[model samples]
Target chain A: MTTLMAWRNLRQDPIRFAATVIGIVFAVVLISLQTGMLLGFMKTSAGLVENAGADVWIMARGTSNVDQSGLLNESAYYRALTVDGVESVARVVIQFSGWKRPDGGMESVILVGFDPRTGMAAPWNIVEGSRDALLAPNAVMVDRLYADKLGVSKLGDRVEIVERMAVIAGFTSGVRTFTQSPYVFTSYNNALRYTNVEHGGASYMLVKAKPGVEPAALAERLGAVLTKEEVLTTSDFASRTRQYWILTTGAGSALIMGAALGGLVGVIIVAQTLYSATVERLAEYATLTAIGAGTGYLNRIVLTQSLIAGGIGFTVAAVIASVLAASSASSPAAVLLPPLAIATIGILTLALCAIASLLAIRKLYTIDPTSVFR
Target chain B: MIQTPESLIVEDAVLTYGKGEFATPALRGVSLTAKPGEVLLIRGPSGSGKTTLLQLMGAMKEPDKGKVSICGTPTTGLSQKRLRAMRLNRIGFVFQFFNLLSSLRAWENIAAPLDIIGMDRGAAEKRAKALLAEFGLADRADHFPKQLSGGQRQRLAVARAIAHDPPVILADEPTAALDTENGQAVAQILRDLAVKEGRIVVLVSHDHRLEPMVDREITIEDGRVVEERGPARPKSNALRSTLSALIEARRAASGDGRGGSGARQEGPRISSLS
Candidate 1:
């Protein structure tokens, strides 16, 4: 019966309830997008390293990120193959190069050259082309999402990378770049012409461990002989690259801080809405207090009202955020509202609303018990 | 020592508001009592400590001095938790403004007290429906407070006050906002609760129309009772004063004070509360 009263009270002022729900919807949408974008950027920062099929990476010493790597000596690849747990090793060359469009325009591109036969360090989200296309003469693959930015309209378009002519043979999808510099995928021999690395030069070595062998242990074994190079498991290198962007570079932290501010704004929206609605009915609350309503029961009434508002607001907001996120899945700014991110927003929205309800409960507590008659 | 069988007792209760130099007395050692099956009216002008005395009797507050016992339970010095329980199970308050939850319908407003006492919703709803039927508001049960007429709303307030079967009912000007017909109707219902239902009904109001229904009336002035007591004083003088005051109050209430005593007042009915 009390719950019925609470529900009725929520609907008693439709305009006020709508205003409250609108506030929560705005707050939730802001929080969801901010959190989703933050997670997306963090995941994008290590996209290449995480997708590599290699169990371990042998790169030049002091290599913090896979994209910003110094060339490993040609001998590092041969030395890693000698390691006990090493099953196979593939040479990979990644270099930042300027792509001069046929229209005299220029944009930054990461020229990722890998062994087409081994398929290690190759682009995986090939939406319109095959990996075998990289074997064609001067052939390369570029993300279809970044085609406009890279000034390449379609397949068979020719562009010059670091002054070397390259032909686009394949188009991939969702191969994100933290720097927003589209990746240009090609064969190992093809990359040697476009980069500073010579024919036998290797920037990094992708090492796969034998089945039942731990990559970390294999990395430790490879680290013994590769004195001038660093041997790290793929997971470790991926984490290092991710941390380098989000924490070390300060850009990621700025995004994280923005998300926190969104949460703070969310708290304020929920708190103000609930507080105003509860305060407006203070006389009714006071009457209840005088008629022997206990603190717990009164608290339940206010909290129940908040939960209803939050439930409705969150449902609408989540759907809006989810649709917004889903629509951007194929765009350059693909937002990843993974289950964890959705769950995180759900928990945060409810927790913030619950905390906001305490303001109303506190007002009820400090009120003069018999002020209803006044 | 034989104890009084009164369902409500207030013995020289003293309550002061504020601290130090700002302190002002609200109840000045006022004493009163009433047994079950009686309607007691505390009539006084504004700021005469009438409501304060009612609050004390209702166990909403403890007196600074003296004791108030309701049905053998002494309210003085009891913890707020205990007082809350005492009020929930024993005392019901009907306020001047009708104080019905505006969000709820007529039946829900009546069921509120029952719900607060931890009664199950189904049983509480059943009890509220029965009370609504008994109060001559059977059809208005589904309506909200704003939808009902002034008289029906006050009648509903009275029904809510007795929903939990409380032995004691305290009302602060329950009919102050109603017209004469509504006021008379509300007053008669309160009279029935005391005479027929065997409950103690205490009213704090200066409305003259309530005079004929009450079994006892205490007129307070400046935080003390207007006790007309002396050997030379005739007992009929008390009755005469009561009748004259009633007429004067009716004139003032009706806004025609040409030959009536100017007894109607306003604001902070409890003295020294400002």
Candidate 2:
């Protein structure tokens, strides 16, 4: 009955109720969308590491993230083979270089080199052509999303990378970097030739463990021969990459702080509106109390009203965020709403409603039932 | 096998407000009792402690000293929870201003007490409807207090007070807000509840016209009872003398030509009467 009374009271004041709910919905949608986009971008920062088909990555000592590792000698591959439980070791090189487009514009790109025969770190998703094309000297693969940006029309077309010409061998999906640049895959030897690095030496080494061997145990054994700052598993590398980007770069902190502020503002505005509505209905509450309604009963009514508003607001906000994410799917903005994000927004909306009704609950408790005599 | 009393008892009831110099006495060493099927009409000028006395009898407030026992239960030592229970189960209160909840409809307002006690909604509603019908408010059962006329609202308040069928009904100026026709109707309802149902009905009001409808009258002055008259008491010099004494006592307590002191001093008299 108390809940029914609360619902009826809220219905009676439609304008106020609607205003508070709309405020909460707006906040939830905005925060959810912004936070989702931020997280999506974070995932992109560690994309290469996450997708690399290797059990372990052997990098230089004191390396914070995979992207900032020191180069190792190509001969290190043979040394890695001598390690017990080691299956295969491949030398890879990654470097940032500018590509000259047909439109006479320059597009910055990250060059990733891998062994063609093993295809261990090859682009897993190809939009056009195949990984075999990379066998050709100076043959390169550009991301599908960046094909037009790189001004390439056909797979056979050529583009200049750091003054060295290369053929557009294929296109791949989701091959993006933290710098918002496209990735171009080529032969490790070819990448070394293009970047002017000494022959027979690569930037890093990716090691795969045998079927019976554990990667962590292999990594530990490899660490004995190498320095403590070198040799990491794929998981370790990815985590390190994420940590470096979040700690050294301001992007993570900025996004989190902005989202926090947005959530606070949203909660305050919605709560204040709800509280005002409750104040306007003071007489109605007093009447209920005078009629022998207990404080718990009255509180249930108010809380139910708040939760109802929160549920409605959260649903509307989630729907709006979903639409935004859908429309922005192809864009670099990548507004993605994970289930956790939606659940968080729902919790936030309920909390905001609860905060807003604090004053109303106190006022309800203080009302003297005998005051109705006046 | 069992004996039941018709009246409520108050032994040496002392109700004081505040403490020390700021303390103001509302009821001072007052004792009174009314028999079953009796209508005790407490009359006095404004601030003669009439309302306070009614509040004490209703168990809304406790006297600072002495015990108030209604239906043979001592209320002085009762915990607040128990006192509230007593009020809910035994006593019904009707305020001067017709304290009906503004949000609820007439029937809902009347059913509130029953609802508080976990009564089924449908049963309580049915009972409230019947009570409203008895009070001539059947057509206004769905109307909110703000939508009803003053008299209709007052009648609804009466219906709500008695909806739980409490043994004692304490009304503080129940007809103060009503016109003569509505006031007579309300008084008649109280009279019927007392005479026909054998319930103790205590009505506190300054309106002397209601005296005729009551079976007995108790008048208070200076926080003490000045007179107790019954239906057998002739309406002659004795009644006039008691009335004049009450007026003089009120004037003396006021000190000033204005009746401000009478208002301040009325609390104790009212408490005593309760």
**Could you tell me the lDDT of residue B215 within candidate 1?**
80
Query: What are the candidates' interface root-mean-square deviations?
Result: 1.3, 3.0
Each candidate's fnat, in order? 0.77, 0.15
lDDT of 1 by residue, A48-97 (tens): 98887999999888988878999876788788878898889999999899
Candidate 2 structure quality by residue, lDDT tens digits, A1-374: 66656676677778877887787777787788778877776777777887778888888777776555677875677778889998888878877778999777998888888877566677868888888888789999988767788899788888889888899988887666666667789988789867856776776778889998999999999888765338888888888888788657877777777777767776677667667766776665655554446677678877888888878888988898888888876665566678887887788778877876776677777765555444
Instruction: Using lDDT, give the best candidate's number.
Output: 1
Interface DockQ per candidate: 0.52, 0.18
Residue A94, candidate 1: Cα error in Å is 0.8
Q: Score each candidate by Cα lDDT.
A: 0.80, 0.73
Give the chain A TM-score for each candidate: 0.96, 0.94
Compute the DockQ of candidate 1: 0.52
DockQ of 2: 0.18
- Restricted to chain B, the TM-score per model reads 0.80, 0.81
For model 2, the docking class works out as incorrect
User: Against the correct fold, how does model 1 do in TM-score?
Assistant: 0.90
lDDT, residue B1, model 1: 15
